[model samples]
Target chain A: MSWELTAADLPDLARGATLLGTGGGGDPYIGSKLVERVLGDGAITVLDPDELPDDAFVIPTAQMGAPTVMIEKIPAGTEPVLALRTLEEHLGRTADATMPIECGGINSMIPFVVAAETGLPVVDADGMGRAFPELSMETFAVYGVHGSPLALAGERGERVIIDTGDDDRQMERLARAVTIRLGGVGHIAEYAMSGADVKRTAVPRTISMALALGRAIRVAREQKRSPFEAIADTLAPTLYSHVRELFVGKVVDVDRRTTEGFARGLARIAPLDGGDELEIAFQNENLTARRGGELLAIVPDLICVVDHETAEPITTEGLRYGQRVRVLGISTPDLMRTPEALAAFGPAAFGLDETFRPVESR
Target chain B: MSWELTAADLPDLARGATLLGTGGGGDPYIGSKLVERVLGDGAITVLDPDELPDDAFVIPTAQMGAPTVMIEKIPAGTEPVLALRTLEEHLGRTADATMPIECGGINSMIPFVVAAETGLPVVDADGMGRAFPELSMETFAVYGVHGSPLALAGERGERVIIDTGDDDRQMERLARAVTIRLGGVGHIAEYAMSGADVKRTAVPRTISMALALGRAIRVAREQKRSPFEAIADTLAPTLYSHVRELFVGKVVDVDRRTTEGFARGLARIAPLDGGDELEIAFQNENLTARRGGELLAIVPDLICVVDHETAEPITTEGLRYGQRVRVLGISTPDLMRTPEALAAFGPAAFGLDETFRPVESR
Candidate 1:
């Protein structure tokens, strides 16, 4: 299936991307504004992996670094184009299309910006169904897709092309170091893949899913219905079928400090009526969620916090004390829960002690 | 004029390079071992910049990161070749010859190692007449030579190519960050230049100067003559004409720490009997030397410490307490003392309060 995504669709897409970002991907409002500024009246053609030829080259682009910094120092709306062009020059081939490397507030929108500028359509899929902090955490990497030759472009037009030769960990390490020096934000084009590779490794139709998710929330709000129920209904037929409202509480503590090009910290939410507190730990994206020391969702599962009334997703950098919110534990797709995927991005990968317990299993 | 650098000549070359290294540029022993392991029976042809055609492509190569870490984690002797090959691939052309980026214990010898392996002649010139801590502090950079596309290769075959356009400072920052992640040391090939650029910016005949200085010391030691006087005599007719014995003292204190991919510290020496102590500050290369409160020598000028009896140069990483030493202040070449060159590697560039004063003027 294919779709045309115009400027009017960005708000809905952003809202849904924020939900899928797992509390860290950069601010959705900023992502929407960047796309709107560049997109104008143009419509981006979004295609499914199956719609492209097997030989079609797909380059995934995203912004890397601390989201906390990104909100203050927004991208110049040109970094993604620079990163894509740099990668193309390094590869000596033009990209057939661009795709999101992961689902997140900014990352999901960055590809569209690149597409608008390059006149290249965007693939409807992504490497990660939901966001993970490091580049190697993607399903593409776990499935043996190379992360280099990776290209990074800063706001100042500085470009760095890294070729680590199958060392994905080194790619993440080197990219993060450069991102810090590039003022804690840099746009990257990496994991250049053929359509076959995308079909094999990418989460299918994630862009459509985000759009549908956002539309569901908006329709629920317009109809004066419960947005949480709308979310459950929207995800019921999707890959993320097991969705649970883990807690309804007010944020009591947020211990976040952006460092090492990442927004790393913890947030605690206590039930307003009095119950065990809910706690979430994150490194860019939420990694683990627990209620009263019992695990509710551990990565590679989605743990998202949203505004209690409007169901607006709250990113990690936006978490604050004394905010009433609803925490959701959404099951990731089976593809992202395989043994290989867990090894790449499970709780242990993020330095958490507990083993991965899926949201539905818990 | 041209010369042949055989394996047997490395010892003298290393000795002279250490003296010119100004307490940094990696350890001479390690550099010698690396070249010896790769050189085998083949001799490296050394050519002056003028010997090559104006359009000849010359790539300067050196080891980056802390010299202390380099001694502990020696290169695999193939890193330089890998670096050079990576750069060649990036440029889409083969290099005509290789040259040292700076004068240092290991840096001056690294180009020889590359030359021996690549069958390319080593240029008898370098960007920095003496070692400086940062990459941009080079005569080539000062006089406007692009430092990219620069290639870095680690022992494990990790390769990174940085293209910062004309922003050399960003190049240094990003490269240093990557070097730190490359286990505190990496091999680098940078400042891809034409023969014309080399002639216009590089300090000419520095390799020949190093060889002569090293041979002078060895001959003086063999003849039971004062090696220090031999040094003075050797440099008298060269670009580094003004030579002064700054101090004769016993080391009393050394405050050194290896951090951020650099060996930074301060050393204090007192006259054997009594008198005002001499304090030398260094970040990889010695930056400033002060006696009591008076500046004896500063950066952009050579400040070397040698063994009291043997007159062998002592590197900053090799500094110890209670060692008898003689400090020498040698003038840098006129090219290095130019206003532009001074602004690049001057005392203030290293965050020193004192201004640069020529050794001859003092």
Candidate 2:
């Protein structure tokens, strides 16, 4: 599959993306703006993971830090290139390159921006095949690929060369330190792998998957199809929802001090579902989802809030009490289902009573 | 050197450590109490770097995050050991010993708590002979040692492992992600290396150095030795000025919106030094110490504010306009100079007009 993403494609991509975001990928609005800035009306060509050569230098790159922070202190957009260039210099090798680190919400277009700047093709695949909170939690980590010796370059000519020598934990530690130093934002080039490594580690053609899901919503809206039906058709999944997002509410409080950018406080969601009530406790991303004392979605899965009609991915910071919202759930796949991953993302991981059971199963 | 710290040792250590903290290492008081909680009447043993066997496993562990955050959310005092134990488990080996990652404020005594709990011999050597902000700006980085496969364990038992396979920058990205996830404060055990690696990379005798310095300040204060003189005797070359602290007045404003728990913000200082007024801008540690008309100590070198006569370290967060304080400058060593180390903490690194001139030469 090939993607020639013109300016016309972005709207549908984002519209469909909110459904795929499952309730936690963060708002695509900021990233969409950046994508538009870079691509303009040009075509964003995306290749299928299988179509690429076996040994292409497949790198997974993105901004890995608090999304809450990124919302406030915008990226210079130049850090991504600086990181890539520095990584190239450090490797003493140049390569057949590809694009974006992940496919969902904002990260989905990073490849296009990077490709436009560095002339590298954006790989249609992504580790985890979705957005995650940590670098180590990606499918690359599931395999033996390490995201180290990462070139964390800020746009302001401040480049941090972090080498954590085969230790998975240290890579995140140092990257985090740089993230804070760089005003809570930094572009990263990581998981520097051969095509062989890419084939084994990455979830192939995840962007196509995203595009397909996106197109589903597109075709749906065009054909008067329900948003949930369109998304489910695109994912080829056996499950999905019919909720429409209507986000317009007042944020009661933003307790950033304790939550530390994790969305913790309740966002009163006076649903267009005509329900009595809905509330969310967020940390970084949305965590628990509830409606009128009914558990809509627990943990270990995504509970995304979108603009009820527009399907705009809503972040915890953006959601407010007394506001209206449409909530939806997206399932976690096998990659984020392992014990380690579960330990990081499960209901128990967030200190909920229930252990991690699959979203579909739960 | 041996230290039998009595219940009475807390105040002097707190004061002296603060003096050594310069202006950026969080409040020494919170850290002082923590050290006191773990160290009560124990005969503390300080060893020279040369004392350890060449092959013994030595690790320097400390908390890595925003110092200001540590106060509101104190550690369970379990983090240092958790980092230690996690590294040991990752290695499938036990640590024969532990050492201070650095000797800045709370970090100075972190090893002591680890020692008392794990019963491991706390080696006297430290990675940074003195304090520098970034985790990688240590003597270990000077010796080409990496700071990863390092584990950060939180009080709530949340842990993430960062291992960047010798790529320094990658580690930072991940660690910070964990830090933000953990409410902006976390404990990290970075730069996992063997005794040989430790021997080559770690600053020799940092423990004895700190103990001597700690003891000297104690003895001098009691024996009528000027505490300043005692400190001068310990560190060799010295430069001191009774520069007033910024934020001497009431903390009229605190910009927490952009603060991800970093020690950041600008404060106006009404100088009590008989010098003109001063203003200071800070990030984590104070980077620039500027007089109203003159650039005193710029970045790359450490600029700390101590109490005018007590030699106590003053954190930037508590700085108001009407306070009385003294500022001191301590230069970084030349041996630990590397592009990354320098880039992370060099004079040019912090946007100063100054070229890199050795303080001794200047």
Candidate 3:
């Protein structure tokens, strides 16, 4: 399905993105505002992956850096288009459409901003179904897409175009360093591919999923029903095989620190009903969710935190002590469950001793 | 004033470059070996800066990152030519000549290796008369050269081409980050300019000076004369206005750390006769030399530490406690004393409370 996104859709989109962010990707408030300002009364056309022609050029883009830094040093609003232009110049072709690299927090809305600025339609898909901290943890990487010829642009008109050949890990490492130097935030356009590749590798319809998710939360709040139930029901019809409410609790402690250009730490959630506590460790996004020594959710799956009452999504940077919250775990898309994908982003990849277990199994 | 640099010149070149390194620029031992292996029996042509044509394209190249890192992860012997190729592709023109970005440590030998591999002549000049830590602290920066369109290449075929647009400080920051990401070391080719611009901005004949300095040290050692006296005599006819023996001491303490892609620390040299101790603080290169708060030499002047008997220049990375050493202060080239030059590399710029006073004055 195709849709036209207008100014009215910004709030819902931001809300949906935050929910899908799963406690990372920074706050979507600034991105939402920037998009709203750039969008004005103009409506942006959102295209389904199937709608794209095989030969159509496509570009995936997102902000690369620490979430904490992105909140403080708000983007100059020119980086996305600048990155797109730089990429276009490098590839010697114009992009037929733009897409979000990840469906998480601020990144989910960045494509819309670019589309609004460049008059390029946004494909309703993303590389990661939900945000993963590192660039190598993307569905595109699993699908063997080259991450190089990546264009990184800073607000100060500084631009770096990287060509890392077949080493995606090195690309991630280099891009992260560039991001830190660019005031800990830089806009990057990577994995330029044909529309055919997009259809093959992308997590399709994520934009629509985010929109529906946002609408569900809004409607649930108005109806005075539990937003957690609404969220689970909202994700039930998606590509995700399972959506379960993991815990209802209050944040008791947050051991967070901004290190090496990342917001890394742990959040301890104490059950309001006085059962076992849930501990979530994160490097930018929530990596693993555990109850005592047992695992509830691990990476390559969605481990999200939301407000206890209104069910507003809380990003990792927004986590604080004494805040009542609800945690949800959604099974990852089947495409992300393969051995290759698991090896790149599984619990063990993050230094956990446990074997791979689906959120559905938990 | 063209000369062929054969295997015979490697020792003197390394020795001379080390002296000019002024207790920074890392060790040249590995670089010398790399160049020697690459050069084999081939002779590289060294062109005088004045001999370059008006339309000839020239680039100043060097290694940018912490010296300590460079010693460990040795170059794959392809970064220089790779960076040159990347730059040439970006500019849509081939390089006519190459030169060291600075006449310090490993950098002074990199161009020779490139010339051996690429069959390109190296200009007998450099952007800095001696090495300074930051990219902005160069004769090219002082003479209004743009540092952008700089190519940075890593060993893993990772390449980043930066277009910084006249902001040298931003260039330095971004390059440093890129270097750290490239395993704390990267080959950088910056300030690509016309031969006219190269002649106008470059510190001419620094290569010949390094050669002379190296040759003098070798001769003194062979003749059983004090190498320090030989060094002073060798520097008498150079652009440097004065050369003075600052201290004869034994290294008592050395404080150093690789931080933010730089070898940063202070080295204390206690007089062998039990006089005041001299402290040299450095960030990659020695920035200041003082005794009990009395400044002896500060950059852009050169403060070099050498073996007390052999006069072998000890790079900042090679400094060690309990070693008998001699410190020498040499006045900077007139081109580096301009107010614009001082502002970029002066004492105050390095967070020192003192103003830049000429080494010749004290």
Candidate 4:
């Protein structure tokens, strides 16, 4: 079904997208402001994958750099539009719609901004159901979509077009270097594809899923009920299943630094009652979680950290030394857990030693 | 006036270009091989700037990276062709001619390779009468030619186009970062301009000057005369005049390393009879020379090091300890010594503390 997203939907969308980010994808509050500024008194048509013609041309848009840097250097709100236009000019074709490259805080909202500016509808699907650091981590790249012929724009209106011709790793390497030189952040339009390709490769209805998850958490708070239970109930019917609260603890340590265009770090959470500690490691998005030397979840699954009481998602850059938090382990979709998808974004891909094991199995 | 450049001209051109390079611009021998392989039985048309039509499109081509890296990793000879083609496609116009961005070893020869492959005439001019480390340090940029919309290609056939509007420094920063990711060497086509702009801003007749200098040294050697005196005679009537041999010494120390895509180093040469030492500092191209605490020459002037007996120019990457050498200081063209040009390529721009004093004035 086609739906509409207005300024009023931003709060819920931001909250839900933050949860899906696992622990990265930049700050949601800033993304919300950028979207609201451009979306003034307007509604964007959100099309389901089935609603699009097979020949529809879609381009995925997102920001590429350290999330921590985005906090200091907020985008000028014109970057995504410039990036999209640059790509459109390069391709010599008008885009039928815009879509998110990943389901993450700012990345999910960026498409809506581009849609508002270009008057193009947005697809409710995304390449990654949740965020991962590198461009090649997406299902679109893992399956068949080319990530090159990518357009990147800086806040200063500087533009660059990269064409690596099917070398996705080279694209990531070159783009990261450019991003660092662009003052640690750049907006990108990449993975241009057809509607049929999207239908075959993307995780469908992720925006709708995020909306439902947001509403569930909001309603649970209103009824004075456990938001975690509401989250479990909300995701029970979705492709991401087997949600569980792994631990509730006070944050004891967070060691993070922005390096090579990524906010990479490790956080340790100690049980309030003095039980075993939970350690979460992240590169942009959380890649691994362990409790007392036992692996609870790894990448290709979701390891999210949230506020203990309010259930608000805390990004990797926002992790603090003394905050009460809850860690949640959720199983990814079967498509994302397959050997091919795992190889693209698994523990091993991020230089982790262990093989991927599903959250449900754990 | 116009001339033809065949494979027979490459050896002499390489020798003279290496001399003009001062101490950078990659290995001239490798560049000679690359141009020879491409030239085959064909001869490229070398046109003086006045020969170009007012509306002719000209693009300057060069290699951008550390000279040391190019020695171990010779180009596939296809990178410059790819770079020129990429830029031409971006501009939506066929190039009428190609020229050197600078008069330096490999850089001066790269346009010949591009011209041979593209069937484009080679302009007998260059942006820099001599080389500087950064892209913006060119007469073309100093005198109002735009350097953006630049195309770069690596040996792996990776292509990137950067458009920074009029921001030349940003173009250099971004291009350098990309070149590093391209494994320390990339061929670039930049400074796209009209024939009018080339005639107004470029150092004219540099190709002819290099050829004359090469022939002078060769004839002097055959007659058992002084090559240094022959060099002085060859340059006396050109825009670059006031040539003088500053020191004859044995190199006692060389502290050099390849960093951030540049060969940066300092060479200390002690007098043969145990007198004052001459110290030369270089970043890609030699920037400054001092003898016993007295400045002898600084950029926008040329400080070239040559074999004491053979007169073969040694690049910064080729500098070694315990080599006998003679340092020559030559005044640059009056066009390059203007306040604007000095501000672009002078000592302060290279992080030296002294103001630029021409070799003749010193």
Candidate 5:
């Protein structure tokens, strides 16, 4: 298949991104619009990782900071390319290509702006098939990739380069804090890699994966079938059974804590279908899902509580009493199924003593 | 040194912590009182890392949230131990030792509480000699240690665990969000390193360094001298320079932004000393300092602005008009000396073009 992103790919890309987000990457609507406004009709050329030359100068780009702030604080929109250019200046070399950090959610579309403005083609792959938090948390870090002399450019008259210890977390910490300081949004060029590292560390064909999922969901919606089932089918992942929700109805309670420049809160849902209640607590993303006295879902996995009708991502802070939602459960990939991952996000980690078995096993 | 914490040491500990914070970590008052209140006159045995047994089970504990919040919602005192006990239960093991993630601020005092309640001796060193912006940004992550089986216990009212792909950022992102959701405070036991990993990965003797610096400051103050000079005398580091106030007067203008859950802001300071005015910016911690368009300090070295008279940590969110402050500069060890560190923290990273020289050189 000839790989090119056109206006037609936007919707599919956004939908696919949400599925890939596994429930925590933030709403794709705003991020999708940013891409759509930048490039339309012209197909984004997708370069296969294998097709890149060994010496290919490739860098992944991303937005770092508060998603809610993204809505209130309009991006300068030029920072993404400026970030790429700053890297080029620091190294005195131009990038041969660009890629996304995650194919799901807003990150899935960031490369489009880079492509449109810089005239660089967006790679069909990404570092993660799904969104993972932090600048250093990528497989690239595991491969010994470093985020130093990072090129950061914000539309609001801010730009800088960060070089840190071989530790990408340092870069992530400083850059993240910087972005928050820069009105909650900043773009950066990171994981500056040789084509070889790009291929070895990044998820291959994540763009196609996103497109496929989006297409699947659209097809299901068009055919009047279950979009949720379609997504589960396409991802080859099953829904966890023990995810019996506490509320099938409206939001009845929300208690918020706003500190550390973040908005955090919990929402209680009362079942329309009949049950005790459900609580979905969130900061910038949904973290824990519980119903009655039973634990439902934990982190490092997508625990989506979507608008029962729209299936759109609703931020935790935006939720209010009497709002309707249906909590959805999604199993995670093996990459996050390692002993390390389970230890970080298993039932035990989230205050639940129940062993987490794959829905398939259950 | 009998390696026993004495009563006189408490004041030094708190004061030194405020200094080491580099103007980012919150006030140490609450944390200090909590520890002092619980462990009155109890000897907190500080074991040099070298003296630690190879089989010793050590867990470093700290509070995760915005420093601004710490001043408002003082911890319930039991939060730290609750987090640790919850972690012990999840690990299905017991901890033989407690350590601070960093020794520069409130975190410096958390281990004391843990030691008093659990009867675990505190380690004498820390991961980062100073405070960092995020949990993943710790010295442990740079050592290829995974921060898993990391349990977070909330004030006994809520407890949750989080696991992420070997990505510390993901862990931070997930954990931070959960912390916010649970009402802005939680205790975390992270980087559960085996005995060997702890030795190689941790920044050794951090506790001693903190105490030494604390003692130095106290002795210097009693003798009537500059506290900044006291720190310089103690660090015996390669560089130390204290800037004469451009303006000792009131704060004039403040710009603020909260993104990615950080209270970021910048303020202008007029000189009461009859010099020119100065502009400073911050996010939880101060990242840059300038006077009359000239850049004075930038990261990975530290730039801290404190009350000119009282060494209180002044967060960016807390910086206001008319607040008198003296800017202090210090150099981090080799971690911030590498080319990578320079690029990540130099003036270029902070949006200035000139290379950052030592403050003492200036």
Candidate 6:
């Protein structure tokens, strides 16, 4: 299915993206403003992957770095277009369509801004069904998409094009360092692929799915119903399986430090009624959720923290003590459950001792 | 004058470059070995800047990062050529000549290695007559050469090409971050200029000057004469004027740390015969020399530390407490004494309170 995304769709899109963000990908506020500014009278055309011509070149773009820094140093509003233009110049061809590298947080809105600015249709698909901390954790990488010949742009028109005979992990290391140098955040355009590869590798219809999820939350709030039940029902029939409420608690503590270009820390949430406390550890994005040493949900699964009363999602950087929140668990898609995907984004991949057991199994 | 650099010249070249290094540019051992390995039967043809065609593309290459890291993580013998090739590819033309960005320590030998490997003639000139810590301190930059459209390559075959609307300082910030990410050292080919710019801005005959200084020290050692005197005499007739012994003492204390991609610290030297102790501060290269708050030598004046007995120059990273050494002060070249040059490399530029006083004035 295809549709034109108008300004009215932005609120739901941003809200839904934050839910999928799982507490990372930066605050969607700046991204929302940027999209709203560029998207004035221009509407973004959303094309399903199958609708694109097989030979058309599809380029994925996103911002990479710390969310804390992004909140302070707003982009000069030129990086995304510059990054896209540079990549196109390097490739000697205009991108037939633009797509988000991931469907979470600010990244989900970035492609729309680029699409509106450049007059290019955005693909309905994304490299990741939900956010993963590192660039190599994308399903596109698992399916053999090289990350280099990548173009990165800073706020001041500083542009760098990298080509490395390195694996995705090395690419991430190099790009992360570049991001830190560019003042802790940079816009990047990578993983240029043909439409056929997009259909085969990407998580399709994630844009539409996020929109539907956002609409459900809005409807639930209007009807005075539980947003948690609304979200679980909204995700039940989708690619994400096994939706459930993990915990309802007040955040007791949050220990986070920005290191090596990532916000890494652990959050302790005490049960609102005084039962066992739940702890969630994160490196940019939520990695594992546990209660008293028993794993509730681990990486390769989704662990989202939302406001207890309003169901508004709080990013990792936005999480603070004393906030009452409800943590929701949702199983990742089958594409991310494969052995290669697990090896790249599983609990063990993040230094956790337990082998990854799907959220559905729990 | 034109000459061929041979294996027989490596020792003198390395030794002279070290003296000119003014306690930075990294250790020359690896560079010596690299040049030796690459220059086996092939000789490096050295050309005076004036002899080159006006339109000929001259590329200056060097390694940028912390000197301490260079001692442990040696390069994989491919970075210079790779950096050159990548730049050539980006510019769509082969470099007509290769030259050192500075005639200090390892950089002095890097061009020779590239020349031997690529069969391009090595220019007998450099951007700096002696070493200065940052990229903007180069004479080329002082004379209006942009450091961009620059290419950097790492040991792991990671290559990056940067083009910025940024000045040289911003370029250094970006490249330094890239070097640190590439395992603390990266070979960069930048400041691509025409032969006319080379003649107008470069420090001419620096390679030959280094060789003569090295030969003088070698001769002084053989004849049991003071190597310090020979070095002063050798530099007296060159662009560098007013050489004198600043202090002769044993190292009392040394404090250093690798921060922001540079080895920054200070060394305190106390007189063995009980006069006044001298203190020298450095950031990769020695920045100032003072005795009890009395300024003796400051950048862009060259401050070098050499073994008191053997007269062998020691870089900042090689300095250790308890080593007996002599500090020498030498005047910077006229090219580096200009208002623009001093603004970029003088004492005040390094955060010193006093205005720059040429070594000759002292």
**Which candidate tops lDDT?**
4
Q: Residues B1-362, candidate 3: write the lDDT tens digits.
A: 98889988889989999988888786677788888998899999999988889889987778887887878888999998899888888878888889998888889988888888888999999988998778777788888888898899988788899988999999898888888777788998888889998889888999999999999999989999978788888888889758888899999988999888788898999997887899999998898899986899888889999888888989877778799998999998888888888887888778888888888997
RMSD of 2: 11.3
Instruction: Give TM-scores of the second chain, every candidate.
Output: 0.98, 0.84, 0.98, 0.98, 0.86, 0.98
**Between the candidate structures 2 and 4, which one is better when assessed by lDDT?**
4
Model 6 residue pairs with clashes: A23-A316
DockQ score for candidate 5: 0.02
Error of 2 at B27 (Å): 3.5
lDDT of 5 by residue, A1-362 (tens): 33777877788878777756654455566677777787866657888887887789888887766555655765667878878886786678899888987666677877788887777888777765566555665656655567775777766434455555475655665566556556567788878888888877666777887787678777877888876666667666321222222235788888876444445567788988686787776654556677777666655455666667655445554566787887766665565555644554445544545666653332
Q: How high is the DockQ of candidate 3?
A: 0.83
In candidate 3, the second chain superimposes onto the true chain B with a TM-score of 0.98
lDDT of 4 by residue, B1-362 (tens): 89999898888888898899899877777888888888898999999899898899998899998888888989998999899999999999878999999877788889988888879999999998877788889999989998999999998889999999999989999999999999999999999999999999999999888878877888899899999889999998899979978899998998998888888888999999987899998888888788888888888888899999878888877778899999999999988888888788877678778987778875
Better of 3 and 4 by TM-score: 4
Question: Worst lDDT window (10 residues) for model 6 chain A?
Answer: A162-171
C-alpha lDDT (0 to 100) for residue A171 of candidate 6: 77
Candidate 2: tens digits of C-alpha lDDT, residues B1-362: 43444436556655555555555555556766676687666645555556667778777778767776766777888777887886676567787777877766677777777776776776766776556566766667656787866677776665556555565555665566567666777777777667777767776664444445567767776787666666666777322212222323223233422264456666555544355655556666666656666666555555666555655557766565456666666665555455655665666654555555433333
The better candidate by lDDT, 1 or 2, is 1
Candidate 4: segments with Cα more than 4 A from true spot:
none
**lDDT of each prediction vs. the true structure?**
0.89, 0.62, 0.87, 0.89, 0.68, 0.88
Best candidate (score: DockQ) = 4
Docking class of 6: medium
Candidate 3, A86-175: lDDT as tens digits: 988877889999999898889988888899898999999998888878887788878978788999999999999999986777888888
Model 2 chain A is weakest, by summed lDDT over 10 consecutive residues, at: A238-247
lDDT of 6 by residue, B1-362 (tens): 78899988999989999999999988777898999998897788999877888898999888887888988988888999999998988888899999999899889988888888899998999988988778877889889888888899998899998888537887888788788878799999999999999988899999999999999999999999989889988988998868978999999988999998888999999999997899999998999999996999988889999999889999887888899999999988888888898888887778888788887786
lDDT of 5 by residue, B68-96 (tens): 66677788788788778766765678888
Q: For residues A1-362, what per-residue lDDT tens digits would candidate 6 score against the true structure?
A: 78999888888888899888898878776888899999987688999887988998989989988877888888888999899998888778889999999898889988988998889999999987888778878888888887788899998889888877547787788788888988898999999999999988899989988888888899899999988788888888888858878899999999999999888999999997887899999998899899996899988788999999979889887778899999988888899889988888888778889888887776
True contacts preserved, each candidate?
A: 0.76, 0.02, 0.96, 0.84, 0.00, 0.93
